[model samples]
Target chain A: MDIIVPIKQVPETSNVKMDPETGTMIRDGVGTVVNPLDLYAIETALRLKEAHGGIVTALTMGPSPAVKALREAIAMGCDEAVFISDRSFGGADSWATSYTIAQAIKQAGRYDLIICGERATDGDTGQVGPGIAAWLDLPLATYVASVTTLPGADAPVGLSVERLVEEGYQILELPLPALLTVVKEIGSPRLPTLRGKKRAKVTEIPLFNAQNLELDPAFIGLKGSPTKVVKVATPKVMRSGTVVRAHDEAEIALAVDRLLAFLDERGLLPRGDRP
Target chain B: MSFVWTLAEQHGGRLKDVSFELLSRGRALADKLDTKLASVVIGDGVSPEQLEALIRRGADEVYAIMDPRLAHFVCETYSNILSHLVKTYQPTIILAAATSMGRTVMPHVAVRVHTGLTADCTELDIEPGTGNLLQTRPAIGGNIMATIKTPQHRPQMATVRPKSSRPLPEDATRVGKVIEVPLIESLIDERVRVTGYRTDTADFVNLEEADVVIAGGRGMKKAEHFGMLHDIAGVFGGVVGASRDAIDRGWLGYSHQIGLSGKTISPRLILTAGISGSIQFLAGIKTSETIVSINTDPDAGLHKVADFGIVGDLFEVLPELQRRLHEHAAAPPAATTATADDERPDERQREERV
Candidate 1:
């Protein structure tokens, strides 16, 4: 079972700080890391390759810089790597992103399963996974908590998937040639191996662009997106909080009592003792 | 008639709530677009009864697929089934509740079908000019609203967060059509298993359905301290609520947490004590009809948002109020003064159990 794991390098959400003045995220000095959720997808593919006998191909659609994420996937145990980077692909929404990745998946051409994170941290819109499924016209399962393959097909891979169902989960079984958006509940991701690390440093990733995909230019970026962000801004402060200081412990208790009375008047206190 | 495609989500040998919710939302979208609503159900043991439910909910046609291979949800097989349906029908839009399963599976379908998808959307609007969906949702921790569209993609896809779309008023009398799609062997090529199933059952009411919500913040201190909040909820026949900090600290379950990353509560009344009312959280439950707050800090944001504010320690006020309310029946207060904290307690609070 050859599995393709698509990884995306996103801005470190932890380092993401809003510029109070501009009200936009300041990504100038913040570093980038592979989307945290994608880790589960990569790890799941590696586990599948280990259990069965197949190679894991790691793919990414970003600038040359995204090679880092691919190498990281290699260091974690993928067999091959591909990079689909070009200026035209920048600023693409889920649609273009899915098209680009889907074309690349077709380029890879012979995979039993495609694994991805449930969603991306930057967009938080989890659309690309299903978009890829839509583009590839393949079966898709999302938020898979667990996976176990079934036996007896030439490209044999039967998955018993524990899908996230809000309150709990729903178990599903699907055959080969499927796309799965994995969840952390699947399994713990493996640590990078020394041998794997050695291979990652020297591997040269294959790069593809719009021409390689033969995709229409108008449909590959902001232009291709059905949804356009007419505007993006931070939420304004609706109300500022008030601060009250107690002069002393005695004042603190008294202040509390007075406030309770105020709450009582407003029904903040459900108890009706003070007439 | 324009085609309407609904992703059939089956769980434990039945269709999930979101599936019906999707059908409901799909019905509205279909009516707006002047299309017929169609549903697809995929599972190994899907029953005709389940198909009837989908029709009752609003599906004009039900597509059914039964295969032992599909008894379990393998991404590859189901995605294949849905893609086939979409290709066959060519619907204009696809919507799924932003539940974990919807979030995960929709992306795969979107990718394969070469479409666009919006995630966790709170609202869906159809563009009058293009007939494209104007999918609106909160972004960046609910700090901003984003409206997305998929211009060229047929069956523009989106996943709605649960509770954002209310279940349409159920009317068994409402009628619709049911069409069952033929089944094929699911394409499954992966290694995974289902060891056991355990559901998270809260001792208290699930906050989602509670009429009254009482959330505790860092002020409450420990996991066990949630007992106080729980106790308070019991007094009002409500459910306990928590802040993100409480849930991340494992002081409360994610199910009970109310914030951007957790559940949102839009009850008739929300009584908050010791909560700071961060913007992210405010965005989550700001839709409540009335808000009453108790905080030691006079300048806490919670007070600003509260319809009525009290600046003091909750520990003293809450206990005393509970005591007084236990004394006797408090006369009905004016509708404007819903809580009526000043009124004397009534025998109702003190009523003993048999």
Candidate 2:
């Protein structure tokens, strides 16, 4: 089984800023990072391959710098890396984003399983993993906190997962060739090995774009995308913090007393157990 | 009218409350667009009786996919079928409740059809000129609300959280057209097979849907001390929640964690104990209609956001409040009826990323 993991190169969210005049994300000096969540995804694939003995191929779609993201996946233990980037692919939304990735996955041939982050931090959409699974017709489980292998690959890889459910945790198991979007419980994820880092430095990543992937122009970019962002602006901030201006301990004592009574009257205090 | 397609969400072959809420939302969008409402039903278990019920609920046309294979929510299968239906029908808008199933299926379907999908939307409106969805959702925590639009796309899609939108009273006998979609074996794969499924066994409050939430923070100091919040929540028929500090300190599980790194909840009444109310914690429950805070510090940060503030030890206040609540058994219940519990996942906080 060949496991393919997809990583995205996103601007470090901390560096994101809006050009107040133009209403766009100011992307200057915003260094790119291998989506931190995808690192867990890459590690999950590598671990699965380690035990199951399958080849792991990491794929990405972005600018030339994106090759580094895939290489990082390689350094983390993936056997191969592929990058898909072109001018035509700019400004694509999640839908078009998944299309680009899916078409690339198809071009790369077969795989038994695909892994990706639960959601990209920059977008926070959490849609792409399931989206790719849909385009590729695979099962998906999201917000997975932990993953434990079950017996039997002939069936779906037995996957024991702990999901953050309605105010609690729900554990479920499913078979392999499935798509999984994980949260923090996949085991701190294996760190990048020195040997693995050395191999990644020398590895050359193959690039594929819309043309090389042989996808129709209409299905490759903004024109093919169903949704487009009309505008982006720095939201007006509201709710200024309040200032307490009393000077002496007497004044402070009086304020505290008043505040306590107010809370009690509102029954803000904890309640007794129900029958 | 620009169209909004609402799923009449059903669980275990039964319709969910969010389905009705979506219908009401869809109805408003339909009226705004000067078009009719389109509702879809999927699953073989939906009987003709159920079909009749959906029409009465306000759908102008209902798309039904009744197949044994489509019974369970296999993500790829649902996406394939829904994407096919949407592409063929071509509604200008689409919506689903942000239930476990909706979140999973909507994103995948949106991608398959090559459209953008917004998640956990709090508000929706129709753009007058283009009839696109003006979908507003919380961003970077609830400190900001971003109203986004997929102006260039058809069938603008999003999933709103349940209870986030109130249900339009269901018209039990209301009626619409029902279109049955043929099944294609090619659309599904058994790449995933289910083994064991364990039901959530903890008997704690469900913070997301609780109208009255009493949350404990790290100041409570231990796992057992969380019981104080639980006692209060029980009296009010509410759920117990925890601040990220409590979870990080191991006083609570990740499931009970609430903040930008946990679940976001806006309850009617929120009573916090020993919490400092960091921006992240406030991000989750700032929408509460009324908030009461208790802390040892006379000037904790929570005092500002909370509608009411108390400067005292929670250990003393909590037990007294619990005793008082029980003493007031003759009093009326604080919140409305319990919210439907059909949702699956807890939440995704902006700060909780790997």
Candidate 3:
């Protein structure tokens, strides 16, 4: 089984904060990291390769800086990493991004499975994985929690996986050459070893651009995106918050009492203590 | 006439509340455009009353397609049917609730039909002069809001957050046309099979249905501290929830997670502790009636949206609040402001148990 895992580099938003005085965002200290979700995808691919006896290839499409994500993937056990970078693919949306990636994957030769993060942290759209499946005409499964290869190991017929649904969990059996978008529940991603890090630092990341993939000019960038952002603005802050502060035990007790009284006024506190 | 279509969602033989909410919103949009509002119901054993209920809840027309294949949601089959409907009807707009089913099927249909779709939209509007559907959603992790438009797509599509709008009152006397689509097995691809489903029995919080939610975030520091959150939730007869960060940290299960990638909940009241409040998480609780936050950071983003906030350590604040609530629960009913008719069964159970 040859598995291809798509990853991306995204701005770290966990510690992103706004400037108090200017009200503008302070992005100086916030650096780019491999999208947190994609780590799970890479780990899933590596696990599949380890069990099924095939090579895991990590793929990504972005500016040249995205090679760092590929290196991280290599350090995490990807046999090889492919980077698709070009000026033409700069401003692509989910649709065009998936198309570009699908084209690149096609140029990378044969693969049995493709794995992707459920959604990117920065875009949070979650359309790319499904879009890639559609563009490639491959069977797609989203929110797959666990995947097990069926009985036919040599030429795997299909996969049995547990899918997370809204109500509960559903077990699904899908045929081969399918795409899966995974969540954090898949598995714990492993840290890179010293030897792996050393090998990854010198590993050549094969770079493929739009020209090399021979992607259609119209379908490679912002021009290919159907949706356009008409406006962007700061969200209006609606609630005017009143902060209750407490320093010591006495103040803490008093604060809890006041909060209970507030709940009482709102009918949220339990009414008429029973038994 | 131009039509605004809402894809009605059903599970366990009952229509989801979001389906009705979407129809209500679609009706308003259709009225604004001087068009018709149509609803499509896809399921097995859909009764006539269920189809009529759609008309009662503001659908001008109901398209019911029944088949055993669609009894359970198969993404490929449903997306194929929806794409076919969109192509044949050529509706001006299509709306679906941003639940797991909608999020899965709508994108497939959009791609099949070669159109664009906006996911988890919080606001929808019709642009004047051009008469295009304007989809507004929090972008870049809620730091900014972006309004998107699919100018070239025929059926502009969006997946809206559930409980974001009020459903129209049901009118028993109202009547509308019901068109039944004949199901063909050849059109359905039966690759995936549903083996079985199992709900989490022990950790079943039912966050979406909970009246009150007590959520913890990354600041809780460890998985064991979630017990503090659970204890506080127990006091209020509420359920426990967590942010995506906490879930990622393995502090809580995915079922309790509330965020863009998790479940969207609109509880009557939500109390969040130790959470810094990312926009992605805020998106899930946008429709919550009352929000309260307890965090050590006074300048946390959660404070901006919270109706009330406390600046302190969650570990300290949680125990203090839990103690006070326990004391109150132990106290007799001295001065009851609640009427006998107003007492909720869950509160009574909590009182009896505590």
Candidate 4:
């Protein structure tokens, strides 16, 4: 099996905060890391290769700094890395992003499976995976948790997978050349080894630009993106209420009384009789 | 005339609550655009009453595409059917819940029709002059809100977060049309097959549906410390939730996680212990009505957003709160003029009565 795993470099979302005075994002010290869930996708691919024997290629579409993400994937045991970056690809939405990536995949070569993280923390849309599958016209599964190969006459022809749904898990069978977006339940990611890190340090990652991939200008970036962000504003922080601090047991008792009274005033306390 | 359409999602022949919510919102958009509000239902043996219920809830028309093969939600088939509908009917706008099925199918359909789609929108409206669909959604882990537009795309598409809005009240006297479209054989793609489904037995409570939620964070320290949250949740007949830190630390299941990557919840009351609210975590619980925080640090970010803050050790405060709750529960019934439960009406029931 030849596996293709798409990954993203995202800002540490938890650290993303707003400057109350200016009402703008505080991006000065915010650092980028491989989207945490993508690590799981890379691990899943590596494990599959270890079990079934295949080459895992890490693919990404971003600015030049995204090579760091690809190298990190290499350190995590991806056999090869493909980077697609160009100024034209900037401001692409999920539709254009998936289109660019799918084109890169086509230009890269053949693959039996494509794995992606369930969703990127920054976008939090979980739309790119399905969008890529749609662009490639490949069978796709989302929120996949587990996978097992189905044996054919001579080699494996398909995969039986468990997909997470609103209710629970749905067992599905998908043929080769299918794409899957995986959730955290897939497995914990393994750390990079010394040998893998050394290989990653020297590995050559080829870049695919719009010119090489023959991407149409009408459908590559913001020009190609159908949806546009017209306006952006910092979300308002609505709470600035009373704060009570308690130290000794007496203060603790007083604090508890105040909390109970607050709840009681709002009629939020549990049903009970009061003295 | 072009309609404002909502794809009604169903499971086991019953419509999901979000489907009705979409219809209600779509009704307003339809009215603003001077168009009809139509709901598309694709499932096997979906009852006439359910189809009519869609109309009663605000759908001017319900397009029922019933077939045995359509019972289970397959992305290929559902999107194919929807793409076909969009091509034929040319709806001005299409709405769906930001659910697994909706998330899967909408993008596929949008791509097929060559249009733009905004995912997980919190607000949707028609632009004043150009009549474009204005879709507003949280971005960058919910620290910023972005208003998006698909000015050139026909059938402007967006998926809304479930529970963000309530379903419109049912009007029994209202009447509408049910148009059943035959399923075309070419639309069915059999590359993927559903074999079986297994319910998740591990989830003790539905976080999204809970009236009250008690969540913990890294300050809870250990996996065992979550017991305090569970005890407090039990007292209020609510559920336990956790921040990403707690979930990543293996102290709680993913289902209990409340954050950007987890479930977005809007419970009536939510209490967080030791949670120094991250932007991502705040995204999920910001819509909650009453937020109470307990943290040893007075300046925790969570305290900044909490309706009430207690700067104390959760270990000491939670046990005390739990004991007080127990005492409250065990108190003599005669002394109370009216119990809280008796006075507080069921929120869902109130919505229905609206």
lDDT of 3 by residue, B1-354 (tens): 679999998775666667778987898889989999999999888778778878988998998888877888877788778888888889999999877778778877777786778887878999998999999876666666668888997799898876566578777788789999987667687777777766654665567656789999989889898888888787777889999899878777777989866766777789999889887788778668788999888888888898888888777888888877887877777565546422232333223322
Evaluation by TM-score, superior candidate among 2 and 3: 3
For A66-185, candidate 2 gives per-residue lDDT tens digits of 787877788788999889999788666677778789889888887877888766655656777887877776667877777777777363356777665443445656666667887654
Candidate closest to the true structure, highest TM-score: 4
lDDT of 1: 0.69
lDDT of 2 at B10: 56
lDDT of 1 by residue, A1-275 (tens): 89999888877643255554433345567688888779889999988888888989999998777789999999999999999999778677777788878888887679999999866665667778767876776666676777888787554656777665444556666667878888655776888999999999999788888777777787786666655554454444353433344444565555445544554654544533454
Interface DockQ of each model: 0.24, 0.28, 0.47, 0.57
DockQ of prediction 1? 0.24
In terms of lDDT, the poorest run of 10 residues in model 1 chain A is A237-246
Interface RMSD of each: 5.8, 5.7, 4.0, 3.0
> Model 4 segments beyond 4 Å from truth?
A13-30, A246-275, B203-206, B209-211, B222-225, B234-237, B323-354
TM-score of 4: 0.90
Candidate 1 per-residue lDDT over residues B24-125, each given as its tens digit: 688888888888888877776778877887777688777787776666665555666777778877888877766555666676677667677788777777
lDDT of 4 by residue, B281-328 (tens): 898888777899999998888889888899999888988888888899
| Model 3 CAPRI quality | acceptable
How far off is residue A117 in model 2, in Å?
Answer: 1.6
TM-scores, in order shown?
Answer: 0.68, 0.79, 0.86, 0.90
The Cα error of candidate 2 at residue B115, in Å, is: 3.1
Candidate 4, backbone clash total = 0
Residues forming the 10-long window of minimal summed lDDT in candidate 4 chain A: A18-27
- Fnat: each model in turn: 0.33, 0.32, 0.62, 0.73
